[model samples]
Target: MRVLLVKLSSLGDVIHTLPALTDAWHAVPDIHFDWVVEEGFAEIPGWHPAVAHAIPAALRRWRRDWRSTRAERHAFRARLRAQRYDRVIDAQGLIKSALVARQAIGPRWGLDRASAREPLAAWTYRHRVRVPREQHAVSRTRALFAAALDYSIPNTVADYGLARERLPVPSTAPGDLLFLHGTTWPSKHWPEAYWCELMALAAADGLRVLLPWGDETEHARAERIAVAGAGHGFVLPRSGLGELAALIASARIVIGVDTGLAHLAAALGTPSVTLYGATRPDRTGTFGEAQIHLSARFPCSPCLTRECGYRGASVVRPACYEALDPARVWAQTRETMSGSREMAHGA
Candidate 1:
């Protein structure tokens, strides 16, 4: 069967949709699958071996320029309509995503009101499947596929694209650790001082640290971490999605504070430890992996506030992640890495 999965925008959301690929592939082992994602995260769906195509759409960028943007959208819509897929699923329950799915070739499907992240997006789907609201993002994604294909889904980690590649990493490496400290939201970031301290602890334990960057903001943070570590860390050049897979595939462990890279590492089956602050990990935490971490002690946690609510709050501080000491994260990193080594040797 030929199917098209439309999920565009936000790196984390795109990563979360990956498990649905597994469901589709499993239901129809010879399924021909294609994906439509935003330009920023176009490399993701390609990581899945089952995906026959990864079509890049730049709705966000196209919206920037009035004339050229309209032309681009028209062109893309024409191309998408030409494919005439047998089935098109809108995993991303957003108006834009729904419209994109509507442009595809066949019967449209998506989650009903309760399951959709955005209720209005449900209007775009001809076949609506009401998913369990309580399920994790991964489960919801899989459920969407299950409902679309009328196939039962088991509680299994069906990661078909995450076959680990043997990228040559250093022996003295900190046991394959990847640190992701970048996000679109300022409130989501753990303090730079905390990251520096975490790096020191990793270096002390003889573990190698890897940093991946796609833009200037993350690149700057990576540079600061390297500088703070006194040249103890490694700087990966700006790379495409394939390079990202190569980098994460080599890691024995992944650590970060609620970023797409952290989630990607988890999706790739690398043991991941993610730190949560303003947003609840329950809504969007690392999944399909055994190793995960979260911190929700702050009274104002999961506020869903973009900027720290210090402006109007009486406390006037970044309460959510302010108290998360680097020492604790470092200790956890050490333990996780040690655990990976022990399991490897059966010690």
Candidate 2:
């Protein structure tokens, strides 16, 4: 069976769909997938052996210059239509994703109106499957696949089904910690002071601290953190998703704010401590072996807001993060690392 999967953009969402592909592959051994993802994240789907093609959809880029990029968009659509897929699944139930699924050559399948994030997107699907919204994002996708493909949803843990060998292993020595501090939302940031303190704690424990950045703003923040560490920390050069994944795969431990890289670390099976400030862990938190989630304890926490609304001058920069002390995070990080090491030795 040939399938076309439409889950575009956002690194975390793309990673979340991998296990669903694994489930489908397990049910139908002859099944092959052709994933339509944001051009930036096209590398992800190919990491799974079940995926035969990773089609790049420049939707984000095309929207910026729709008139000028008409030819390119036409060419991509032509290429997509040329393939004869048996089914097209839109795991991402947004209007934009539904539109992408409609361009394919098979019966479109997606979440029903009652279960979709956007009710309007459900109308585009020829076959709509209702998946429970209360479950984690991973479980919802797995359930959607099971329902759409006429297979039973397994009662086991999620298997990301990515080959570790596809990513180049970093040369960094063992016991080195990688801090993924770059995130899209301001409210999700762990305080810079807390990061510095955590670096100092890791340095005292003889662990080398490495900070990875995405943009200019994150680069500057990473430099400041490195400077604050005085000699114990180093800022990594700007890296693509694959390079960063390689680094994460090699790191002894990853301590990160709620970001896609944190999710990538968890998916890579790296021991990690993910600090949550404004978001709740029950719905979208990173989940895997040795992955620890630490959520804030403030009343206004998990507000799911993009910006900090606390107005008190006496409060921390992001007051929600104040509840997560760096010392406590460090303690958890150490415990997770120790447990991972023991497991590795036992295996």
lDDT of each: 0.76, 0.87
In candidate 2, the residue pairs with backbone N, CA or C atoms under 3 Å apart (3 or more residues apart, or in different chains) clash, namely none
What is the Cα root-mean-square deviation between model 1 and the actual structure?
3.1
**Residues 204-254, model 2: lDDT tens digits:** 887778888888999998998887676878887767777788888888999
Clashing pairs in 1: 84-105, 173-208, 174-207, 174-208
Question: What's the lDDT of the predicted structure labeled candidate 1?
Answer: 0.76
The most accurate candidate by lDDT is 2
Candidate 1: residue 17 Cα off by (Å): 1.8
Displacement of the residue 207 alpha carbon in candidate 1, Å: 2.9
Cα RMSD (Å) between model 2 and the true structure?
1.4
Model 1, stretches more than 4 Å misplaced?
Answer: 158-160, 163-175, 310-317
Q: Model 1: per-residue lDDT, tens digit, 1-347?
A: 88898888677788787777777777776787788999777666666776888888988777777686787788888878876787899988888899889888899999888788889999888999988877778788888888887789857774635444423334333325778877778888888777888888777766678776768988988887876555568867766665666677677878887887777777777887888878778767887655577685777787787788754443323566665677777777767777877888996
TM-score of each: 0.90, 0.97
Clashes within 3 Å, all models in order? 4, 0
State candidate 2's TM-score.
0.97
